[model samples]
Target: MKKSRYIILLPLFISLTIPVVFALTSKGQMLENFKRQEKEMIFESQTIFLDEGDRNILKTYNKLNVYSSIGDKIQSKREYLEVQNEKINSRVNSLESSIIQFDKDIEELVIEVNKINEQVVSTKDEIDTNKKTIDILQSRIEESTVILLEYIVYLYKKGDYVTTDNDIDNIKSILLSGEKIDELVNDLYFKSIIQLTGQQLIEKHRDFVSRLYVKKLELQESENQLKTLRKQGILERNILDDKRSSKQRILEITKGQEELYQKYISEQLELERDIKVKELKEQIKLNNTKKKLLEKYNCEFVDIQVQQTEFSALDEQCANINKIIFAESRLSGIPLENNPLDWPVNPSLGISSYFNDTGYQRLFGTDHDAIDIMIPMRTEIRAPMDGYVVFIQPVVNTGYAYFAVKHSDGLVSLYGHVNQIDVKLYDFVKKGDVIGLTGGEYGTNGAGLLSTGPHLHFVVYDEEEYNDPLNYLNLSYLSYKSLPSKYQFKYKSDFKSRKGFEYADTSKKQSTSGSTFVIEGENELERQKYLLGTYAVGDFRNWDIWVEESIAGGIDPTFMMCVGLAETSLGKYLKSAYNIGNVGNNDRGDTKDFPNARSAIAAMTSTFNNKYLGKYNTINQLSRYGNKTGAIYASSDFNWHNNITKCMSHVKGEYIPDDYNYRISIK
Candidate 1:
């Protein structure tokens, strides 16, 4: 009974233990998976951050925002700087204008000062002249006074009034005899005569003296008037001196003003220089700041990458936990699957050409690579399968309108000659989704080089190579026989050949020469070696060779004859379809007839090689066919025949040419 009870308890214990073990194991696995997934997420984030696309996006965002901010700041600063500069300029202009005006004033003042100095000099000369005149007048006045006194004393000593009078008259005559003073003083001296008798002279000496005194007084008054005149002359001279002094003072003031103005101009110039220097310094600082901000943005992007990685890790951990918990939740659930095959167009009309063999070449070669279904103009075209829109190219030569859809399993279908493309690239499309409509006569037939008639060319490629959709679909050639009569396609009988020659000429004219070659040196060996090297390994589609021999011969290297061998295998082949020269078409010409083969090869080779490479002299020297001096023959002195042999041997030989070492030795 106890054993049975332990057994029943064991069941409960096992159940509890199993769940614990499972939970622990799941938790550990979830943690481990989370760590692994987190590391992967971190690595992916790092890769994305470093990838060009993501880096460009980040860089653009940073550049745009940083540049915008910097630009805004720069604009604001520029505006402010402009205002400040204007202010400084205004100050400078004002200062300069004031200096100019001051200079003008100084010039005027200088002129005035110069005039004052001249006046001062003139005044000093006039004062000196007046002083000399005053000195002469004083000496004359003193001499006249002394002579009159002597004459009065002589009359008293002579004891004869008449003699005294005579003596006085002699004195007056002497005093009046000098220049212009003689007329005025002669008249004044003669106006009152002095006489003294012997008796009367002694008795009435007092009375005579008195009379003489009165006469003397009158003479003294005239002398005083002369003195006053001299005083007035001195006063006038002083006034002129004062005027000259005032003028000198004004000149000094004007000179001082000029100096002050110059000082102000110097100060203004220095201030402007200082302001400019400050502005340059600020600009440098702003640029450094912008650089620092860019560095910070880079750091921020790195931090964001780290954070995103952390978040992804956490999300993965939580997802694992949920998966573990919900493993059996959908065990009995049903899944829905839908497979839809889309028609290429709307079902408004029947398919004129079914996807099958029609016993003839349609468009893509001897066997049609695609199915041609005739439709009306402007008919809507749709997607044939649920896929992603891969390409929508509207190239003129290849297709009038074309769109491609990429499905799962590397399957791709093309709809050509479309009128329009409504869907965008990488768009997820379902079957029967409308892409575009058909239009133009060109769409009906391929048109120009590619043509048949108005029909939709539907092609499906598997893994990039063209494949017959009918074969892949495992359908019969006439599987649509059971369908309605409208869906059947009518086969053409005895159709005329298209005018393909005109189209070929047009295409040739339009085609561009796609390759160029250059010879390395002026030596014949170098030229031959260059041709051999290029022709042996170069792409056959577009090829040309240049040599220095053309330059020495005064011909363009582009027109060199031997260069065509690199393309047409030395006159062996001519491409008739595009009127191009190639190595593959050699078998078409008669091998027995050397002239016909050579002529055909030479004509095609000359046309293409000359057209593209003739511009340079390097290629012209290598021409063995078109030299004017007839030096290109096999027996020419330039060893033209030997060079061709060397080139052919070098290119065709499995190892290096036998002459290569000998050529090196000669060099």
Candidate 2:
């Protein structure tokens, strides 16, 4: 019985110890997992190792996918725009035809109206002549009536004269002797016959006058009807002309809109193609080694599906990383220098994400170690300082490409998401040397597993620990408006007044003045060149030559430089080498090349003098788009004139502003 009791107790003790052991094991596993997760949170690319065949397959697949997708989009968009443009062309043709017809109809109507007017004038003249003739006939009729009355009175008086008392016996004697009485009454009888004939003539004249009056009334009525028809024809012609003008105006507006839309689409597509093609080329370069290795090993392509893992604890650890970076900044002996480094990218493109951004951590599930610079994909990446490339990791399918440079004075810079690197390991680079092309496209080659978009991930290390890049770069060139409110307050003292032009103020100087084209003194010219960034490189380096040549060619030196900036960003990146002005000879295929940049400048001045001088001499005149000269100069871009003139104003140093959006593209 004692043995049975001991056995039951042993089972209960085993049950109690089993749960405790299990709980302890679980706690140890959780602690290990937390440590592994913390290690994965940092941007470490050392663990990503791929076989030769798999790397080639991924590189090729990514290239094909990116190019095919972009190509398809371009083709579809171009087709859609073409279809719309065709419709607009057809409408314009129809309107043009209708306008021609309207003009012809209006001309014909004017002729018809003129003919009707002539007929009305002739009818009026005839009415006037008829009135004059009727007045003459009425006067003759009155004269004849008065003479007839006088003759009647004279005959009555003759009868009274023969009634004397003695006449009775004498008249009886005369009647007995009738042959002698004929002489006495003959004169009276003749006068009375003349009067009767005159009265008959007057009656005929009155009838003729009545007929003339009726004809005059008919002529006047016909003239009034013809005048009404002339007015109607004019009204109809005016209405037709108005419709033609309205339609013509609409056609012009539609054509202009079509050009602008086509240009916008072309620019957007061109930018995308440029980025993808460049990325593909760089990938090909990177895969050359893998291709050789694959052939040597005769390795088959292996498909591996990588699962993305997430750890909620990583965010808290990243916050601690930020603290470590801040502590390093304080421990370092190096103080902030005044503009120690040139901007890696264009200053016009402001920063997108700041270093140690809290908002970035909340959205991305990790703290950002570096600043993400805003720029288009495939933009040139320049070294911030003279340094030697120490480390380079070209990204594969699940890894990001980045390169680190060991700069002087214990400072190190790592440029991340670089698809194309011009420098290799241990290669020395200058401060402004183009090291590689930028890459951060989602799912594209060299874009890491956690990339949000296309941007430069720039990180600076102060004594081997991560720090802010802004500590080295000049903050004065940056715009206050682009910074966050907190940053604005923090860097308020660093903001300086720039001498460049301001876009907000309209009262600034214009390009019309002759002084606008000349940078007054030598010192002023250098200052403007430095401000515009043209003094650093290219043909503008020989600024004295530019000024002398411009003056010889009858163009202003300042305006010429501004045009160069507008066309090619001061020859920083040109579409065609040595074609500084981008002047075309009306042939799209005509790519003219000058021997040197100075020669190209000379060619530009010559072209302007010979082709465009007398006609489009002024900036305002050249800006009249759709005019003879404006369309020839820049048909694709409507803002060409505004851009050039704005550059000119900036160069003259007339726009001194307290604050400006320095990131805006003045070109």
**Local distance difference test, candidate 2:** 0.54
lDDT of 2 at 239: 69
lDDT of 1: 0.41
Which has the greatest TM-score?
2
Residue-wise C-alpha lDDT for candidate 1, range 82-187, written one tens digit per residue: 4554355345435545545555655565565566556556655555554555455455545654554455456445655434455556545655564222222222
Per-candidate TM-scores read 0.22, 0.27
* Poorest 10 consecutive residues by lDDT, candidate 1: 7-16
Top lDDT: which candidate number? 2
Error of 1 at 130 (Å): 99
Per-candidate count of clashing residue pairs (backbone under 3 Å): 18, 0
